[model samples]
Target: MEKITSNQNSRVKDWKRMQTKKGRVKSGQYVIEGWHIVDEAIRHRQTIKELMVVDESYLGALPVDDTTQVFIITPEIAKHISSTETPQGVFAVLDTQDYHEKIPDELQGAWLLLDNIQDPGNIGTMVRTADAAGLDGIVFGKGSADIYNPKVVRSMQGSQFHMKLFTGDILDWMAAFQNAGIKTYGTELNDQAVSYDTVKPTSQFALVMGNEGNGVDPEILEKTDQNLYIPMKGEAESLNVAVATGILLFKFVK
Candidate 1:
C-alpha cells in the first residue's frame, strides 16, 4: 500500500473525475464513498479500481479485508474525491455493471417497472421496496431516471447490489416477457381499469408504474395484459411515486 501526502496526486484527480456523469460515461466507472458502500460493493465482487482512504485512521475505522490497490491520501485529498458534504474518509472507484448483468433473463418474477419516472429518489425507493418485497427485478423505461446515477445509488442504500435492473425500452421488455408467457400489469387511473386485487397472479409477471403527473403512457397500457389501479378511498387524489410503490408492493406480496 502506498500513502500519498500531496493533494494533487493523479490518482486523486482520476477518482474525482468520476463525480460527473460524463466522466462516469467516458471512464465506465463510478465513485462509491463511505466504508459501508465500499465494503458492500467489494462483498458483491464488484470490480474496484482503487480503495482510497485518508489515512490509517480510516483503515482502523473499517475492518481490513482482501482489498486490492489500497491508496492513502490527505483529508483534503479524500474530500476532493467525494461529492458529499462530510467526507467519509474513504472512497472507491467501481466498475459499472454491464448490460447483461444489469438485466437478468428471469426479470419478471415479481417485476417493478418504471415508466418515464423522473425522480431518482422515487426510482431508488421503488427498487429498495421491490428488493424488500422479494421481487425478481426492476425495469426502467427509455425516459426513466438512470439507475446508475449517484443520487439513486445513495438513496437505494445498497439495494442496487441485491436486485436486478434493466434500463431499456419498456415495450421491448413487455414483448420479451409476454413471449415467454409472463403476464404484464400496468397502473392506470381510468374507469375501464381493473382493481389491483381482482385477479390472482399465477406466474412470473411485471408491475409497471408511470410518470408522476401523467401516469402510464397509453402506448404502454395498450401493450400490457392488465390495467390495475390502487383505490384511493380517502380525500387525497394520489400518492407520491415511492409511497405508492410501497403500498402496491405490500399488496403484491400480501
Candidate 2:
C-alpha cells in the first residue's frame, strides 16, 4: 500500500480534480467518498481504480483485489479530497461508465428522462426514487445536472449502482421509444395535458421531468405522446422536482 501525506502530492491533485465535471471528463474517472457508496461500488462490480483512506484500520475486509491500488491518506488529504463538512476518511476513485455507446439496440421498460434539471440534490433524489420504483434506467438529457457530481453521488445513497443511467438527446430517446412501441409522457400543464391519474400505469414508458424553474421544454413536450399534470388541491403552486418525480414514477410502475 502507498501512503500520501501531502495535499500537494501529484496524485492528490488529480483526485481533487475529479470533483469537477471537466476534470472527470478529462480523466475519465470520478471520486466517491464514504463507506456505503464505496461498498456499493464493490458489490456492484464497478471498476474501482484506487482506494484512499485515512487509516489502514478502515480497510477491513474490503473485497478489492490486487488490481486496485490502495493509498493511505492523512486526514488533511482526506479533507482536501472531500466535499462535505466532515470527511468520511474513506474515498474511492472509479472509472466513469460510458453508457452512451452501450444503449441497447431496442430500448425497453420504464425510463425516467431528465430535461435540463440543474440541482444535484434533485437529480440524486429522482435517481434513488427511480431505483426504488424499479425503473429500468434513467436518461440524462443535454442540460441536466452531471450524474457524477460529488454531491449528486452522495445524495443518491448508492442507488446509482442499482440502475442503468444514460446520457443523450431527449428527442432521440423519444424517437427510440416510439420505434419500440413504448409511449413517452411529458410533465406539463398546457391545455392539451391531462391529469397524471387519468393514464393507466404500464410496464414500459418514458416519463420526462423538466427543469426546476421551467417545466419541460416546449419542443420536447410537443414530441411526447401525451402530457401529464399533477392536480394540486392545496394552495401549493408546485412540487419540488424530486418530490413530483417520486409521485409520478410510483404511479407509472405496475
Candidate 3:
C-alpha cells in the first residue's frame, strides 16, 4: 500500500473533487466515507477503485482483492476529503454506476419515481425506505437530488447497495410504465386525487413523489393513472416527502 501525507497531493486533490457532482461526473467516480458504507460497497460487489485509511490497522482482513489500490492517508488528508464534521478516517473510491444508456427490457415489480425531490436527506431516507419495503428500483427523475451526493449517500446508510437506482426524465418513465401496463400513481392533494389507502396494493406499480415544497409537477400528475393523498387526522398541514414516501411504500407493498 502507498502512503500519502500531504493534502496537496494530486490524488488527494482528486478525491476531494469527488465531493461535488461535477467532479463525480467528470471522473465517473465517487468517494464514500465511513467504514459501514465502505464495507457495504465491498460486500455488494461495487466496482471499487481505491481504499484509503488513516491507519494500517484498517487494512487487515479486508475483503478487497489485489486489484483495488490501498492507501495510508493521514488524518489530515482524511479530513480534507471528508464531507462529515468528524472524519471517519476511512474512505473508498468507487466507479459510478452508469444506467443512463441502458434501460431494462422489461419493467417489473414496484418502483419509486422521484419527481424534482431535491433534499439530500429526503432522497436518502426514501431510498432506505424503498429498500426496506423491497421495492425493485428507484428512478431519479429530472431535478431530483444527485444520488452520489456525499450527504445523500451518508443519509442512505448503505441501503443504496441493496436495490436498483436509475436516472432519467420522469415523463419518459411514465411513458415506459404505460407501455408496460403498470399503473403509475402520483402524490398530490388536488381534486380528483383519492386517499392513498383506497388503491389496492399490487406487486407491480410505480409511485411518484414530488418536490419538498411544490409537490409533484402538474404535468406529471396529469399523466399518472391516479393521484393519491394521505388523509391526516392531525393538525399538520403536510408531511415530509420522505415520511410520506415510507407510509405510501409500505402501504403499497402490503
lDDT of each: 0.78, 0.91, 0.91
lDDT of 3 by residue, 91-203 (tens): 99988888554557898899999999999999999999999999999999889889999988998988878888899988989998999999999999978999999988789
Give the deviation of candidate 1 from the true structure as CA RMSD. 2.6
Clashing pairs in 1: none
Q: For candidate 2, what is the TM-score?
A: 0.96
Provide the lowest-lDDT 10-residue window in model 1.
99-108
How many clashing residue pairs appear in each of the predictions shown? 0, 0, 0
* TM-score of every candidate: 0.87, 0.96, 0.96
After TM-score superposition, the amount by which residue 50's alpha carbon in candidate 1 deviates from its true location, in angstroms, is: 1.2
TM-score of 1: 0.87
**Candidate 2 weakest ten by summed lDDT:** 97-106
254: Cα error in model 3, Å = 4.0
Q: What lDDT score goes with residue 218 in model 3? A: 95
